[model samples]
Every structure is written in structure tokens, then in C-alpha cells.
Target: MPPRPRPRPRVAVVVFPGSNCEQDVAYALNWLGLDSAYVWHGDHSLDGFGAVVLPGGFSYGDYLRCGAIARFSPIMDAVTRFARAGRPVLGICNGFQILAEAHLLPGALLRNAGLKFICRDVALRVEARCDWLDAPTGSVLHLPINHNEGNFVCDSATLDDLRADDRVIVRYCDEEGRTDGVSAPNGALDNIAGITNAARNVFGLMPHPERAVDPTVGGSDGQLVFQSLLQQFTQEVF
Candidate 1:
């Protein structure tokens, strides 16, 4: 009998000093029955994983900036290479900020509009089609967000370019669940919550989809994102 074949779409979740979601992310992937492992920041090696995820947390205690220091870790050296190679890379929350700092994408993450740390579950709408999931065009999602710097900003030209490229993903909506397609004075532009880089392989978002993998948690929309990626991985495994 031939080898069953190693898991396709293998993923590595980078674990930094203060990463609070490493295990949760690993668990989410495991629940989806996809092969995933936690990679150390100083490892400098990805072991040939097909995807990489930078989970949420105050890495280096949010010193300097959320993901600023983690970007210099040995593993990021490999991350830089993997991302540039067009492999799938997902960054959530602080991970988003780090990606921007690494120049893997445009824009910077700033403090929330109210200048206060926020920790609560929120809803997001998928505004753009993406390979991240078979997410329906107008799907609404709910997940937790805990951050002091979740604001997204970029120059006008760059913002226009990203818009032209269809890089924007999720966005925040109003009480009636309506959105104007612009970030409110609340930090995000067009209420943007997530986006992918130019290569369409690197993705980053400010919400915690992994936290909503189960319906008992009061929201199941988060599951689709992981499900879509897992399906993609399963297809690639063959």
C-alpha cells in the first residue's frame, strides 16, 4: 500500500511570547480535521507547511507596537520568504499590524476610534469574494475582537489601488446591520475588518474567527472561513 499521503494544505500557527490564541487556533484547525502545528517564533523554519497563521495576542507585550517585534523574530525571516512565495498567510488582529509593518501589505493599524481597548464579540460582513472561503457574497459573521490598535489606514492612492484590486474582505456594519462601505470614525475605512495582500495569498483580519467555530458560542459564521480553507487544503492534498 502506498503512503496515505501527508495532509495537504498543512498550516503553521506562529506562537509568540504573549500569543493568547495559539492553542485555540490549533484546536480550530484540528476540529476541521486539517493538519496544523504551532511553530515557535525563534524556530526560523516552517517545516514545509503550506499555510501560516499569526494568531492574536500582545506579542512582546505589545511593546513598540503589536506585531513590530515579532516581525524580527527568526521565524518571520521564514515567514517573509513563505509569504513572498505566494503561500497562504493569515494574520489576525495584531498579526494584521505586523504584516503591515513587514511591508507584506499596505496600511497601518492605529488605536480604535475611541482610544480605548475594546473586548467584545462583533459582527462582520463579507464584502468581497475570496479564496478564504466559499463565503456567500453577503454573508454576515460574528466573532470576538480585543484590541487597542485595530484601526486601518493607508494613503489615498494605495487605498484606491486596493479597492481596484478587490483586496478588501470583511467590513463592520451598523445597528440595523447596514453598512455604508466605509470605515466609520471608528478606525476602519469603509468599516473594513479584513483584507488580503496583492498576491491574494496573504490575508489579515482584526476579528477572531477561530473563536466562533461552534454554534454553542452564539455564532457559527466563523466556521465557514475555516471550512473554506480546510476544503481548499483537502483538495490540494490530493
Candidate 2:
């Protein structure tokens, strides 16, 4: 018999009651030739999925705080288990907030320094490489960020640890890739736009890479994020 082809990897995109970006994330995954399925927040299992994504949205209408209530969703328990197993997990925008609230990642997102919602394309400087983001160090990517509370803050000790361990994945920057606070849209500490856990399997970012996958609409720099994950999956790294 001929050698059988390996099954394509499938990703689970978790959807909470107020989640609005699940479809966008699924679309981006499909566009990248990966199968994706919506897993409701109430679901208790994450079996048979190669990776998980918590896309951006106002979960529970952002009451109390962004992602505060969503952290208690039944599916989050599964997500926590999956992440602890060294599986890949991605959290974007509001999703990032949920992860922080769940203590999956360090730090909290505060209201924007301007106290206004920001929705626009922003430049990001790739600071480190991992399973999710394979962009070359110092490279710049343009991704859209839409949120009211995107200012990332943490205690000085945590910030120092993240920097010392090279867990800071991306930082807001100028078009030329300068990461000075001058270009930080939400006043995140050290202009951090994204970060990875110590194991580097879990990633969280404030920007929306799914919104920037098509060049005709904006640019395709966001593809790098998904592509890297897919590549890692292909290598059986999960």
C-alpha cells in the first residue's frame, strides 16, 4: 500500500457570548489552508485540536473588565489544560485580557492612556521568535489594533523577568521599526504589543493579525504569525 498522507491540522477558535472575531480568525486559518472550528466558551473539551485561538472581542460585554468574566467560561479550563500540556495557544486583543485574568500569562491590560478606543493599523517590531511568530528579529509588521483597554502593565519585577528571558515577542514601533514610546498607541509598558509565556507555546498580543492577512485590504504581514504556527505543527512540535 502507498504511504498515507498525514491529516491536516485543525485549530479550535474559542467563542464567548460576546466574541465577534471568531469568524475572522476561522477565515484567516482557512485562507492559510488550515482547518478551523468554532468551540463555544461553554465547551469543556479541547481534544483533537492541534492549537487553540482566543480571538478578540468584548466578552461578556467587557463588563467589570475586558475578559474578566470570560475567564470563568467552562472552555477556559480546557484551554488552561491544553496550554499546560505544551500545546499552542494564541490570544488576541480581548483574548489577551482573558489569558491574563486566567493567569496563563503575566500582566494586565489597562484602559488606554488616552481613555479612548483605538482602531487603526500599527507597526510592530518583532523582538523574539517562537512557534507562533517566526518573523526575523527587528522586522516590522503592520497589524490592526481595535480596543478600549490595550495598555499592557505589570509589576516591575515581572517586566524585568519577561525582558530577561526574551519572552517579549513584539513591541509597538515606528514604520522604520523603532520601538520608542513615541509610537506606542496605548502606552503599554516598554511599548509591548505581544508576548509569549516562558515555554513559548502560549502567545498573546493586542494587535489583530487576522485583520491584516490580505494585502488588498491592508497588508499580509500578519500571515507570518499563522504560517509559523502551521509550520511548527507540520514538524510535530506540538
Candidate 3:
């Protein structure tokens, strides 16, 4: 008999109590012909999943701080282990806050410099290549962002290390892909919009890539992010 076809990789989209973007992420993954399943916050295991995504939304009602309460969710333990194993993990917006709170990625997201919620499409320049984002460096991606505290901040030492190691995955940029404070919607330090862990497996960004996958609704630049992930899985690079 001919060799059997490999099963499609399955991504686990963790759903917290107030998470509103889980379905969006699932739809984007399914649109790309990949399998996706929702993992409740109370679940303790992430077995049989090829990747994990913590979608954007208000977790635990954003009490105390964004993601501060969600960090203790029962499923976070599994998510932590999955990340440590070098598996791909992508967190968006509030998801980014959760990753930071869990210490899976460096830095903390502070209130917007203007102290007002911002929701709009912004230009992002890919600063580095990683498992989650394989787009060419300096490429521009326009994605939507909606949050009150999307400003990314880190200690000076960590900032130096991130720059030296090329861990800054993306930065807010102008139409010409020039990064500066003027282009930063939330005043993120160094115009950072996204970053990856030292292993380059865990990626967290404040933009809503899930909301930009379909050209009908908006642009399709967000598809690049998911496409890169699927490529990695197809190559068995996980």
C-alpha cells in the first residue's frame, strides 16, 4: 500500500474565562487547513498538541493586572511545560501579558503611554526570524491591536540582551518600515511590537494577527504568521 498521509498538526487554543479571541484563532488555523482544538483553562494536560496559542482577550476580567490572575490558571502549568520542551507557543495581546506574567517571555506590558485604549491597524516591521515568524527581516505586516496596556517595558539590561541576541521579533514601524517612538501606538520601548524567547520557540506580540488573516475583513498579512507555523510542523521541526 502507498504510505499513509501524515496527520495534520493540531494546535491547542487555550480559553480563559473571559477570553474572546479563541474562536478567532481557531478559525484562522482551520482556514489554513490545520486542525485546532480549544483547551479550557482548567485543563492540566496538553498532550497530543503540536502547538499552543493564548489568544487575545480580558482574562480573569483583567483584575489586579492583565494576565496576573490568568497566570495561575490550571492549564498554565501544561503550557509552561510545553514551552520548555521547545514546542511552538504564540501569545497575542492579552496573551502576551499572560506570557510575561508567567515568565515565559521577558518584559512587562504597562499601560498605554496615553492612558487610553487604542484600537486600530498598525504597521509592524519584522526584526528577526523565528519558528513562529519566518517572514523576511524588515518585511512589513499590518495588523490590528486593541488594548489598554500594550506598552512593552523591560529593564535596561534585558533590553541590551534582547538587542544583542536578535530576540526582538517585530517593532512598530512607519509606512516605510522605519521604527521610532512616533510609530509606536502604545509607546513600547524601542518601538517593540513583538519578541521571542531565548529558544525562539515562544513568541508573544500585542498585535491581533488572528483578526487579519482574511483579506475580506482586512489585509492578509497575518496569514504569514500562521503559514510559517504550519511550515515548521510540516517539516517536523517541532
Candidate 4:
């Protein structure tokens, strides 16, 4: 008999009306050899996919709240279910707001400390031993961040719980990858830029790694994140 065909990993990138990075995310995934596609906000089925990504954009125009209206969309119901199964779920920028709004993740993203919409390249340090990156303990990943509401805040007790649970992902840092009192654009707690749900399957962040996939664009630091996740899922399913 012919060798068994390796199963292709799949990703569902949720598309809200204002989502601008869906294609960028898809391109990145496809380039990385994953079977990925865009899932409309109205599509409620996640049958063929093992992973889901909520791409960055101004969902609902950041009205009322960043992801307030998006949490009520039809597809989010399915996204929640996938997350419950311990499937990988990633949310970027506005998608981070939606996840927090849905209570899939903790804390809330507030306006920047400077009270201005900031957009530029910012350095980040990976804090925990994560399946999504599997990066070395002190690895630093530099990428772009663009948002009006990128401040991450939670109560002291909750923050402590997150730390103990190891839910924190990317954190703001300087060229030296220090997470001290250096303020990037917003004053995120402990310089936090990304976090995962209690289960670690659901992740959300403010930076755009998809936007930095090419050396022609100045850096390819974000590609490791996708590779790490791909390796993680392949090890389990294959």
C-alpha cells in the first residue's frame, strides 16, 4: 500500500467586515504550508480545522468597545467551542479585544497611555515556555504594533493568577529585551503585549507578526511563531 498521506493542518481565520489582515494572515499560513482559509463571521462550522486565528482589524469600527459587537457574531460561537476542545486559537489586535470581550481571555485592552493611536515597530520578549513559540527562555521577537486600544489591564489578584498559570505570552521590551519600566506606547501591565486563555489554547496579542514575515520588509522574526505552532500540532495529530 502507498504510504499514508500526512494530514494537512488547517486554520480558520475569522473575517469581520472591517478585518484587513485576513488575507495577510492567510498568505502567511499558506506560505508556511498550512491549509488555511477565511471563515466569515456568519459561518458557524469549524469541522475541518484544527486551529483558528482571529485576524487584526477595527472590528465594528472600535465602536462602543473594540470587540463588543464582534463577540456576538455567529462564528464566535463556534470559535468558543473549538477553544474549549483545547484547539489552538489565536487573536490579533482587534481580535484580542474580541477574545477579551467574549471572556475567552482575561483583562481588557484600554486606550494607550499616551492616549493616541500608535503604530510602529516595537520589540517584544517571550516570557513563558509556550507551545505556540517553543522559543528559548529569553528569546526576543520584534514586530509591528498598531492600535488605539492596546493597553492591557486586569485586577491585581487576576494578574497574579495569570502569572501563576503561565498565560502571559508576548511582552513589551526595549532593544535589550528588558521588561522593566520601559513604556512602549501604552502602559500595559508588566509591559504585556499578548496573553493566552487559561487553557493555553486561546491566544491574543497586539503585534502583527504576519506583517513581518519577509526579510524584504526588514525582518522575519514572526515566522518562528507559526513554525512553532505547526510543529506542535503536527506532533500531536501526525
Candidate 3 yields a Cα-based lDDT of 0.93
lDDT string for model 2 (22-119, tens) is 99899889888889999999999999999999999999999999999999999999999999999899999999999999999999999999989999
TM-score of each: 0.91, 0.97, 0.97, 0.95
Q: Record all residue pairs in model 2 with backbone atoms less than 3 Å apart, i.e. clashing.
A: none
Model 3: C-alpha RMSD to truth?
A: 1.2
> What lDDT does the true structure give each of the candidates?
0.81, 0.92, 0.93, 0.86
Ranking by TM-score: 3, 2, 4, 1
Candidate 3 weakest ten by summed lDDT = 178-187
Evaluated with lDDT, which candidate comes out highest? Answer: 3
User: Relative to the unseen true structure, what is the C-alpha lDDT of residue 22 in candidate 4, on a scale of 0 to 100?
Assistant: 95
Candidate 4 per-residue lDDT over residues 1-238, each given as its tens digit: 9988788768888999789889988988887787898899989898888788899998788889999999999999899998898888889899899999999999999999899898899999888755556677568888999899999999999899888887788889988888877886788887889888777778889998888876676478878778877887678764
For model 4, the superposed segments whose C-alpha errors exceed 4 Å read 1-4
Instruction: Indicate the TM-score of model 1.
Output: 0.91
TM-score (C-alpha, index-matched) for candidate 2: 0.97
Off by over 4 Å in 2: 181-183
Candidate rank order under lDDT? 3, 2, 4, 1
Find the 10 residues in a row with the least total lDDT in model 1: 177-186
